[model samples]
Target: MNFKELGISEDIIQVLKNTGITKPTVIQQESIRFIKEGRDVIAEAQTGTGKTLAFLLPIFENISPNINTVQVLIVSPTRELAIQLTEVAMKLKEAKDINILAAYGGKDIGSQLKKLKGNIHLIIATPGRLLDHLRRKTIDLSKLKTLVLDEADQMLFMGFKNEVEAIIKETNKKRQTLCFSATMDSQVKKLAYRYMNDPLMVTVKKEEVTLNNIKQHVVETTDRRKQDALCKVLDEDNPFMAIIFCRTKRRADNLEVALHQRGYNCEKLHGDLIQAKRERIMKAFRNADIQYLIATDVAARGLDVSGVGHIYNYDIPENVETYIHRIGRTGRAGETGYTCLFIDPKDQRTLEEIEKTIKFKIPRRELNI
Candidate 1:
């Protein structure tokens, strides 16, 4: 359906149309109406389903520009996701003089404290960093009208449950709450039951896992030969942008070095890098200055990068869920993409598990070294 029919403001509708977003996705059409009506919502949608704008549009519409205190608080699982949410918030620049800030760990808290000073309308933050601000009294959530837990299941997996609980306790209990996740584990369900009112539940059915639009293959090689194989694949495919997921931070760093040594523009992202450095690398990658990104699962989850033509699993993730998240980087928005997995004999069991989860056998391709 058209966004105008969904009761969006004329100015916001103009902005959306300018971005070529005339029609709402299923999640947006279902959730935005209730959100505009000021009801708590729990949404289950996979990545790349246009969930970001679904919540952001309604929140921006309901925001009272007059009130200076933090009216909307969004808690994300990672610094990358927090930055992405802030970017979406900034896109709604039609809001008059609204100040938005993102707070996360591994960055200068002093600078974030300075930004929190006056007339801040929206705050997007990682759980630990938000708790730090709450403890320092640098920000107050007493005026909070809306609370959103974006990627709630991931936050729980990352062991931020206590911090999230503490932050919620500091906010006004009467505030409207919204929770969104790809998979709702029991922990996420319990949090919703405890914090949310009779929430409207909306779920998008999981799409069939298919490689029709995305060409999938495997590179069978030893650990030492995998780097060279990756370079060869890139040389052949010539992707405009790509993300290579490794299983560990050290491996991601080493892969970045190897790719750079071979004269490929690349960057590394992991939990070890400082938040500022991570931001810089992501910015470079997004701008196409860095064509290849080597990342670990923790650093890559919840990132919203479009036009990624290639996704290479430098190492098969231990769990099938992570495998799903990794390959999800490509084949987005009906675009043709490609994914290659570097698998050794030892990883056969993991591959089996992934196959079981997807309920389809991934086609195998033998690579000539």
Candidate 2:
């Protein structure tokens, strides 16, 4: 269906078309009408499925520019996601002059306070900082018409369930609520039951967690020689743009340094980096100035880069869900992609668990080099 049929404005549709998003995604098609109808919705969709636009489009339709006093509140788990949401909102609302603010920690609270005092139409915030604002009573949610919990599973995983509940209590009970997640775990369901009023559940399912267009392979190597194994794989793939997932920030930092020393165009992303630097790195990577991005799971939560041709698991994630999320970075937007995972002996059990979760064994390759 077209964006106009989904009740998106002609101006916003033009903006989307200019951005090359003419057709609605699966998540967008399912969730937009429900959201526009003012129904509570629990939408479960995979990463890179255009979930952001699903909720945002409905919000843009509902918000009124004349009576703006924070009509919509979007709570996200990570600052990166919050920032990305704010960017999308700004683009859609630019012609309409709707004010948008992204509130998150690791930034100046005084400045956020100043923005909060203005006639803001929408706010995209992390739970911690939004709670801070709630505590200070600097922002009022009395006029809120909608509340969005983006990445609900991730918020619960980060131990923000209580915070999220508290934030919801501050909003009007009759207000529209929407929860979006990659998985509809029990916690997400409970939150929906307790808060949402007869919510519509929408899920985009896959027979397996792995993507069909993505070629997956595993390289067996010793822990001591895993670095060499990764180098060998990079030499072979020569990907146009790649992301390497590490288990920790220290590992990401070390890999960034090592890869640069080896003369690869690479960058590192983790929690330790300041917000400005993180944005700069993301910008560079999107522009293809940085060919490889080494990141931790938390740091890569809201990454929506296109043309990510390869994903390298420098260290296998502890769980199958994380592995799916990490590899979901590639094989997006109908593009074929590749994934190479380096596994050590100690990771055999985890590999088995991953295989069990995804319901297929990844083809194994010996590190012949």
Candidate 3:
């Protein structure tokens, strides 16, 4: 359904129209009404399903323009996700004078402290960094009206449960709580029960891994030969932008170096890189200066890069859900894309799980030497 049918504000509708987001996704259509009504919500939607906008829009509408003492608090698992959410919030360009800031670790605390002094309506932060600010008494969440745990499962996975609990206890007890995750585990459910009031639960069905607009294929090769095979694919396809997923930081770094040595414009992103370097590499990739981005799953998570024409799985993901998140980097916003997975014989079990979860067999493509 169109956003207008949801009774959104005219200003929001105009902003959405300018971005060509005339219609709401299934999750948005269902959750927007409840969120607008200021209800606690538990939404389960896959990545690349426009879930970010689903919660942000309602928060924007409900915010009071004059009183801006951090009305909305969005906690993300990674620094990259926090930054991405802030960017999305900025795009709203609400009629009210609202300031949205993102705070994360590994950056100069001085800059973040300076931004905190301003009138902030919304603060998107990572758990560790947010707690650091809380310890310094720099952030005042006394006026917090809504608290969102975006990618709740990932936060738990990252071992931020204690920090998250601490942060929640600091907020107003009567505040509204919202949680969104691609997959929910027992711990995640327990966290919700402990923190959230009687909340409405919404689960958006997981679609098949292979989008109709994307062509998914696998190339079987040994670990030693995977780079050569990837090079061959790049030579043949020459995609405008491609994201190569490695299993670990070392793998990503090695792949990046190999690609560079071969005279390809490539960058590496992993947890090892400093925040500034990661940001610079991401900027280059976004600006189309770097055609290839080799990253580990953690580093790539929560990145909202656009125009990625191809996704290469240099190492098969350990879990089926990760596979879904990996391939999702491409074929976004109704754009046609390509996904290729380098599968070794040892990864058969993981491949089977992925196929079962997605309910489709990935087509196998033989490498042409």
Candidate 4:
């Protein structure tokens, strides 16, 4: 079902639509309703399950834009995750008048304190840094309306149990709690049982789909001839939509120009573009207005565009994991996918390593051009 069917507000729904998030994940669909009801929730879902939006959307729905006193406190386990969550919050809250802060170690506390002086409505923080704020009395959570323990098991694993519990104790006792963990171990369950109020537990039962279903082939070509090889494959396959991955931003840019000169409906995405332009290109690509996206690995990470029928490796990835990640972009949600690899003679060793890891030999096709 759509985000609107999950009972979210229209503005956030429009934001999601602009970002090409037209459908909810299984976890989002299952958990959004309970969260909107203000029920304590213990969700079992792995990373990349769209769990962040599941909670963030409902939190936005329940929050007061005017009566802002850190209404929602989302405790993640890492600086990276807190920052990522803050970015997502910023993007989603564009239509609403909400202020957010990401508090984690490695950042200047003074800067955070400066931002905290404002009417911050939400905080996504790591345990240690959040506890620092608590001990210093620089932030007040007495009026906290909801508490989220994201990656609960990871926090315990990282030995932040005490700090998290301390942060939890400072919040309102009657506040709604949402705990999301990849696995509901004994410690996670105990933490939930002690804090949550009759929490409803739900899991996105299906495991992430594998890449084995993606049709794979290797094309023998050198760096000088890779573009011609890609064009040949593009003409041969006529993929519905494809992501042509290049090893570097320069490669992506050159490929975009070459393809554009040949009258291909394509665009390039890399870190060089301004954030606004990158977002606009992404919106266009997600809407299928662009037939091909030439992108660097950095710019295309974590993209979940649906209906991607093919993946083209215009440049051989550095390693097997990178190779897998590139091809894994397609063949999502039970849809069949196709991937073509163009490798030069020098890339044969890396290709062999990848084949040995996946235990599947990539059938090769020679290009006459």
Task: List the lowest-lDDT window of 10 residues for candidate 4.
Answer: 204-213
Per-residue lDDT of candidate 3, residues 1-369 (tens digit)? 778777688888888887667778878888998998989999887777788988998999898878858899999998888877877788896544587777887766677557657678888899988888889888889889999999998899889999999999889999999999888789888999888888999888766323657889989898878889999988988999999999989888888888999999889999888888988888788788999999998898877677898999999998986887888878876778899999888998999898887778999888787
How high is each candidate's TM-score? 0.92, 0.93, 0.91, 0.64
The TM-score of predicted model 4 comes to 0.64
Candidate rank order under TM-score? 2, 1, 3, 4
What's the lDDT for all of these models? 0.84, 0.87, 0.86, 0.84
Best of the two (2, 4) by lDDT: 2
Model 4 alpha-carbon miss at residue 126, Å: 1.3
lDDT of 2 by residue, 1-369 (tens): 989898888889888987778899888999999899999999988778889999999898888988958899999999898877877787887646787877897767677557556778888999999999889887789879999999999899999999999999899878999999988989889988899899999998752334777889999998789888999889988999999999999999888888999999999999999999998898899879999999999899879887899999999998987888888888876678899889989999999998888788999976667
Runs in model 2 deviating more than 4 A are 112-117, 206-209, 365-368
Residue-level lDDT of model 4, residues 31-91, one tens digit each, is 9999999999999876556888989999999889889588999998765467568778988
The superposed Cα distance between candidate 1 and the true structure at residue 193, in angstroms, equals: 1.5
lDDT of 2 at 178: 95
Report the C-alpha displacement of residue 268, candidate 3, in angstroms.
Answer: 1.0
Lowest lDDT sum, 10 consecutive residues, model 2, at: 204-213
Per model, how many backbone clashes are there? 0, 0, 0, 0
* Window of ten residues with lowest summed lDDT in model 1: 205-214
